[model samples]
Target: MGELEQKFAAAFLTEGRWILYFKGLGVTLGIAVLAAILGVIFGTVLGIMKLSFREDGKKTLWNILATAYVDVIRGTPSVLQLLIMWFIVFATWNNGVAVASISFGLNSAAYVSEIVRGGILAVDVGQMEAGRSLGLSKAMTMRYIILPQALKNMVPPLGNEFITLLKETAIVGYVSLTDLTRAANQIASRTYEAFMPLIGTAVIYFVVIKILTLLLGVLERRLRESDQR
Candidate 1:
């Protein structure tokens, strides 16, 4: 066997080292899911506030604050944001997972807010008018009529955001959080076999992203069919 093959065998195919990868995968997934959920909730509120009442020619305090947050987050690199969160914003907090989650969640929210805002704007004005004609208040119209269609539009972009956020969690390793990338790095350092460990990590990420993309495609197709029916 070649030297590379020997390294691979020693690093991954022996002594249950693959378990490290599994554990790292769990941490990565946990961070991604938590961040994505929080991002969606926070982004939805920001999107609604930014989009709402704009026709009235006045901005609310919430809108101003949301706008500033989105701009700051979107304008900054995510790695920088992560460092700031870990070292500065939550300096007193010792939970790496929670810190990583909040950091990525806030970063993801900026993009998600734009996606949601675009989706809501894509909804027809006539829908809101019709709901209003039926005595629905603006809030009721949004909740009952506008939001459903907007949510459908939001799914594709939101799925993309989740995938992006999943990959971004690799940076959590910088804060000493042992995610998949960090686990692979540790293996590389210990085994002195960078190729096998790093390549394996890349393959794992690719496989996960491919599976998620396939699922999202199926969901989009079903939504299209439902709209047709």
Candidate 2:
């Protein structure tokens, strides 16, 4: 037990190294949460634009632009996108957190746009027809009838997407930002022990993801309950 304690002490407790982990956690959560918000907002707009052709199957400019955005983002590597944003687009900006947040948000928006478009399309055709039959216009039916039902379908996928974005934030280290994974790597370099730092970081990530999964489950249950009522 003393040997185990020594290893633990050397890995984490030495010279206030544990502070690194806490700082990294703050950066990770901050960038992920901010990125998720931006993704949802921008993705919703892209999704709406992507659906612009649904009315008459015409290829509108908005739909074309949205399609191009989604395609390019999906085709490229996320790390490259981060590098481009940091080294080129926001080169003068020294805020690593903000840069990472925007980069990940842009990447996430592509996928989230697809999710949003699918969720909206998944609603029953009858729902829209029924709304229109009741003297509602296309936009009104979409807002009043279709969207409410679609929200439930959207929740699960959106939750999953945000969770993925959370994990992907680990790459923020490429920009010299000491996020969680980077913190652990730094710890390993300091202590010359891979087991403790890496494993500890993995545990931290698993705990966060598990908690989020549980919360999503609760939300799903509530959505079901609302449907029943």
TM-score of each: 0.94, 0.96
lDDT of 2 by residue, 1-229 (tens): 8977887888788899889998999999999999999999999999989988745778799999999999999999999999999999999999999999999999999999999999999998999889999999999999988988888999999999989999999999999999999999998888888888898899999999999999999998888886746
Candidate 2 differs from the real structure by a C-alpha RMSD in angstroms, to one decimal, of 1.4
Candidate 2 Cα errors over 4 Å, as ranges: 54-56
How much is the lDDT of residue 158 in candidate 2?
97
Q: Ten consecutive residues with minimal summed lDDT in candidate 1?
A: 48-57
Clashing pairs in 1: none
Q: For residues 1-229, write the lDDT of model 1, one tens digit per residue.
A: 5987888887787778899999999999999999999999999888987875566788878888999999999899999999999999999999999999999998888889999999999999999999999999988999989998998999999999999999999988889989999989988888887889999999999999999999999998887786756
Cα lDDT, all candidates:
0.91, 0.93
Off by over 4 Å in 1: 54-56
Q: How big is the RMSD of model 1?
A: 1.6
